[model samples]
Target: MASGISDAQLAVFVLSLRRSNPPSDTSIVLFMDSVSPRAREIMEAHAVEGVVFDKSKFGDIHPSTYRWPMITEAVEGRGAAVGNVLVADIRDMAFQGDPFEVIGREGGGLHVFTGVEHITLGKDGWNGGWVRDCFGERLLESIKDEVIICSGVSVGDRDNMVGYLKMMSSEMDLPSFKQCERNGVDQGVHNVLVHTGRLKGGGVDVKVHRQGGGTVANMQAGVAKYRRGEGVVNGEGRMVDVVHQYDRDGELQDHLFREFVEWDMAVEGVGEGGCEGYIIKENTEAYKGICDLSHDPGSDYLECCKVCNGKPNCRGFTHIRKGCWLKTCGNNGNKELKVVGATGAWKV
Candidate 1:
């Protein structure tokens, strides 16, 4: 299934990035292997470069049937000379500052730096210092393996990323992967590769940043001595570009994101063609379809949306009978009604 984030959040992110990062010859690229029906329409309407599985490349089957392998394929022959391949899984990002400037090119090496709660790290609860102060080492170790990574947003040179990408395509579990609903398995392989010293060939670095101390840091900020390593995940050397509040729910996250979007809008207005400028039609024939799928034979609105399979920039969707509503997301529901309401003269 596609991620549960709404299209509005995505629109805000793209818009924010356009203004924050501005642009250069560096063509910011956003890639997705499989795009849902209406979601594709929405993103395309916005003018974002959206890629779906090329049938010539995919054939008639669930694209996810070959997820890891295919995603690894998409990364191929792409990131070589791009300004900076700042890749973000659809659900794995929040654009705080200009990611273009913040996320360095892979030339420096493979690195993932995101702010996760300091309470969680490795197998043990907290290292000797932070959590130890709270519960001591013995108690912390008791809950080892119970932790989850918040978001280790990595950055790197990505020169030979194709190499590892290819390897993963071959090594990633296939049909048998149904039984492997484990952690981010692909990233697990990546972690193993980096820690074991496998990605140093064409020069890519992998680094992570976990939340431990009080404040976030930028390159010039006071990070730890070891975190400054060329490829250290959970490093403290720099202020994070985005903080993933993964703990929150969908609606609440939207509320929080509004502050961010409004801040950006205030700072620099809507970006010229930054977001995939989309508008939804209200009272169109589409709503009847939404009412059908929404309360339909299978009330799993989310699952139906999942069956649709959305990708990056392919923001939120509403499944219906005859057709689906692709764009029109801002807050709780479709934005057309709210937009009309604000107009006052258009109300029924």
Candidate 2:
């Protein structure tokens, strides 16, 4: 379910799930292109099972391209087994309760949830506007007022989930989606399929879960409604089963993560490392940068470190051929050295 090195956010996500659900009732399956040493260590520490895939199958396509195919492979490889399948974004997520329990309460049908954004199509939202432009005026005019669907969190029974992912993968190759061949297309196609009832065409029952109203709470646009408590509660004051896109709000994200860290320490007697006044030395090949997680470039090493330092959970940064890559220390802030062509530094 993750593609790269394990970070602090990923640790928080898995740990939250472990804390919320007992292993006897839940199992964690991780799918990755390749597991890094740090990621492997965390997986061993948490007893998470991993499935590795050959990256060449998808080529050097967008990260969104891997989403559906991976899900399809995982579900189908299990013989289309009967169980609730939750496809979630690992980074920037934390669990307050058992997700399967919430889904069970929803009567055990197909459900897709979206993170709410403040801006809408043809307005100030750049991504939404691009989607509108790609589909043209006529198509957008029909659903101009519809809420944007987020592809981050999706859940359904095994058969339905596999069917949904297969549909999405097929739709991505269509001529109509040619112009939409960029990032966020997965979400665009998801919205189109659900809003237009394409899933129904395949005899799949689907329901749209909106932010602040569903078992899963998307904080992308509803950060104000998130208060620091035992768990995140929606506007109606009900505890949400799953929370997504919290990293969009730095203050709230930091608070929630710190809360989890405190809880982990108090309950499990575990301690975490801190990064303060640390700098990654230049020409260090071990911590070579793999990829840039930033949306933009042009940040120098000092600037990148400062940005990472200012962030609540950021522990280190990798400056490489591409750009700056920020990292979290997870349980241990100590930077793991591996041969690469980038420099890594840490700060608290």
Candidate 3:
């Protein structure tokens, strides 16, 4: 689920999912507040099949908290028609492989991914505060040392996920939960339920996967091993199925952005019109620049493209090797030179 995401964010996610080779029968249900026309068009162009866009709103409750309830209702409505269900964050998420590949065989349980090996509820400031505010300091103290169970991504059987989502939804309605303004209180609730054995009491089996050893990787919590073409990989060096919180790492983020951009560009009209108001040219370099802008130290063309796109009066940028030069056309001086091993883009 997503809210207030840009076209590029939406494009990267759906496009990555489509590229990951999900089963032919798999369906994608997007519970989002809004999606621009350009974003929808990008999804269609990528041949993202069996997608249902749900725009349901839960008054006053933040999307992060309300998504559980929404997912609960959706799962219950589907009955036993679907197999496994994955609840994931959108904007910062990308797929390297089929997410359902491992879950399909696991069967009838909630699969939770933990954060960095040693980081716990009390140690991580954001999560610690959320748990304290929404649940209480006592609850936080109870499982303070336990490895944090992240709610950013989760997988389970249809029935089990429904039960889990129902519990999360019911908890969100509590006075303490409603009074809390924090966006990710759901993660606190999630960790509480998993560590406290609440789901087991409710007849749901919970399986916890450790960071760097699981199918899902949280780039923000741990030092994730990232490859240019493979994305994030586990200890075995195989590409992980889902990469969450990827935006936390600048280099990884740029790599994935360029990968998605390259992929989008391959699909004819997708690159031209999907992101909107910008044209991307492969193997092309900007001839002249008004000024040069440095990236995040080690960043490449992707960061350069991003910088130029966001900067006002930055008509274009030329990427060469490890550097990118921002350009401004003076009397139409911004020319596209066909330079190999480079990319140029400009906002019209």
Candidate 4:
């Protein structure tokens, strides 16, 4: 759930949450940015009954939405409020474990917690290379799952949420900079204020969970990157989560799927969490080489940009491990908007 959750997947996610038997903390507020009418419809359908619709004051928009300067715009507010809250992805589908059981109250301020994707297996270690390059090896331990902590599943208390948002929004110059759930992204953003040495003196342990997604569905065959230490692929020789494009009624659209199927076949089937194109963030590296990269050097990847540096993709990546998967745009190459599957089938 850290990196993906599509409109189709989100529908199932909301329905599933509503269907969970034991029921979870009523305080959990599902927050997301809406773009098109279709996306909003999906949200309204999945929303809990009786909960009044309140636009996220921060006004978060999807990465595709042109209003933002940052890839993820929702982590701007978190430390002002004091109520318990959970922020999960739309595809985080099932809620097997009771969140209240996992989230307990701590010292003076609340301590939000979340599971960080393992550097090689879970989180995108390579993209975080800039942090390492900027901060060095010691940062590897202290700031280990920094990005994923900000991007993945999270739990927060109001005070910490708002206070943290104030710091990030102001310090980072986030837009509008309002205090709302939209600012509640994963990264233990309040780490410095809440989890620092002062809290440790009180024996507070605000740390990353290190494991995401529970056992059942997570154990499915096609989900793992490798089976018995070997590469994984479906019976059709296509990778897991193939982007098959189709019409509204679910008809195959081979032309759209061609690019990805071509890219997949070309790359010997991209690794785990493969994508037909970037979500403006390119190549679901989670499926491919997205290993415990943050933990080990091998878990890393590099970006190669040249245009901005006056070269194009070759301009110079500046050593950051972020870039969208290249697209064939007018022979020059650009990131695409949507990923149409190889055979024009339903993506969901």
Candidate 5:
């Protein structure tokens, strides 16, 4: 279940999942917000193969918290007919194999994924801050050495997943948790539940699977091994079933975009070559329609600039959130705009 995911990204996730698992053996229900016409088309195309899209709304609550209750309600509606369940982020995830293969038909345990080795929750700045913000420093210190368990993905049997979601939904209902509108605060709550034995008390058999040790790979943490088409693999060298945060690697993200979503880099005007000799400016962006080429979304600033350099008469570029606007300039160079999380570069 996800909100604000682009149509391109939705295609990648749903198509890849359908590709790996036959509809006869698997059922897919996607809970989404504001489904566009194109998104409806994509979902409808797969509806015959057991893909169901349910438009969801949770008012103004942050998606991280609202998704839990919504998911819980959806699963509970299925009653005894529901089987295994895999809760995952849609925008940045893709499947390379049958995700349920490892869990099996009688999925009995709540399986969660952790980051790669050596990146403990306490040691990481962003994750650590999330813990401190939500649970206070004392609670964080108790499990400071624990590896980061990403809340974005998890799999279990219907009962176990529903149980875990119930715990999460009830906790997020508290006044304190409701005030945490920021994204990623759920991670703190999730870790607290697992390490403090709260989940176990709720009848959830939590099983922690480290990166490369399980069916899922947290790409942001790092992967020990990866295959070109297969993505991250385990210590045993088998291809992982699901890959999360794959956008961290620009090349691999592009590969999946092209293969699964049919993202046409050539049509998008992305080309090779570094931004050598190009001036670098911090926190700048080019205004729209300044370039011959349209804006292109990439993984980072360097990739944006590289796309600019690859185009003809490209004089400058503005970048933010993996988007690049290649710009053409007059003899005086392009005018700069001040935007946070945005960068602009130009040549004299």
Candidate 6:
């Protein structure tokens, strides 16, 4: 499950998962601050299940504080219905294959993945500097070189996963966590807990999956390592099942989205039929006046189509030189002002 995901991000994430995994094999649960109309539209369009949680319930604390509670809810709510659970970030993430299969092979009790080690310590990384400032230099020096744990993707058996979340929730109340607030507390506290062997005592059997031969991969080092068509591979040259933190690199993020998500959406005729339960008027003029959605004069017609398709109430769009306008009232807004050089099309 994920939280605070925007409409566009949710669209790609849900669509990509559907393309990669069949409904019989997997179920998706999304946790968000609140579901907006657009979010509801996307969820309905993609058939994704969503759960709402109020971030304000946690009181004056870091936003990441909600992660533990949301994850715990998912784990306990599902109960024994699902044998395993994967709590992951929705943004900048895509599934190339069935994540459950990977988790099954990993032999999970409680599995966590390691991110880039270079930035885990020293003054170079913000997390490192924050750790020193919060916990003091003494604690920082003790585990400065240890590999930082990424809280993005985690997997385990239902009971063990719930146990881990319970432990993490309790840790958030510690006094030291106050100093680490607003920083990367999720990762910092998680790493500290694991490094100190605190989770082991809870029967978590914490298994750390490093860079290679792991189900989930963290692309914190940038996009140089991932080839265009071969997918993201680890040191062992095996394709990673789930990729996280890809947004760190804009170019790579776009590349992956286009390959894994956009292509499938286009092929599957998603939003190709204009508004749902409405007839679209093609090659018509929006003489009533145009409502420009994008000001980019050089925007492509296909892009305009996509923008209109994503909007739930959009009935049609008019494309002109470097401008795109989406109409909500269908073909009855106004017939007075004639728009010159605008070609209108329905989102089929």
lDDT of 1: 0.38
Candidate 3 on 23-106: residue-level lDDT in tens? 465667776566566767876676543234444545566778767777787778887787878888887888887887767656
- How far out, in Å, is residue 188 in model 2? 0.5
For candidate 6, lDDT tens digit of each residue in 194-238?
776788987888989887667677888432257676767766777
2 against 4, candidate with superior lDDT:
2
| Candidate 6 error regions (>4 Å) | 57-59, 119-124, 133-136, 222-224, 259-348
RMSD (Cα, Å) for all candidates, in order, is 14.1, 9.0, 8.3, 14.0, 8.3, 11.5
Query: For model 5, which pairs clash?
Result: 284-343, 284-344
| Local distance difference test scores for all models | 0.38, 0.64, 0.70, 0.31, 0.73, 0.65
- Ranked by lDDT, top first: 5, 3, 6, 2, 1, 4
For residue 336, give model 3's deviation from the true position in Å. Answer: 17
- Clash pairs, candidate 6, are 272-348, 273-348, 274-347, 288-334, 297-322, 298-322
**Candidate 1 regions with alpha-carbon error over 4 angstroms:** 1-5, 23-46, 54-68, 102-107, 114-152, 173-183, 200-203, 212-239, 245-252, 256-348
Which of the two candidates, 1 or 3, achieves a greater lDDT against the reference?
3
Candidate 4 C-alpha lDDT tens digits along 235-300: 343232211112211111122233222223212222123222222122222222211112111112
In the range 36-101, model 5's lDDT, one tens digit per residue, is 777888777776222233334445667777778878987899898888888888878988887777
Please give the clash total of every predicted structure, in order.
39, 7, 0, 60, 2, 6
lDDT: which candidate is best?
5
**Model 4, residue 101: displacement in angstroms?**
3.1
* lDDT over C-alpha atoms for residue 229 of model 4: 24
Q: Please report the candidate that would top TM-score against the real structure.
A: 5
Candidate 4: residue 50 lDDT (0-100): 21
lDDT of 1 at 68: 49
Off by more than 4 A, model 4? 1-5, 21-42, 45-82, 91-94, 104-127, 133-150, 163-171, 174-207, 212-348
Q: Where does the lowest 10-residue lDDT sum fall in candidate 3?
A: 265-274
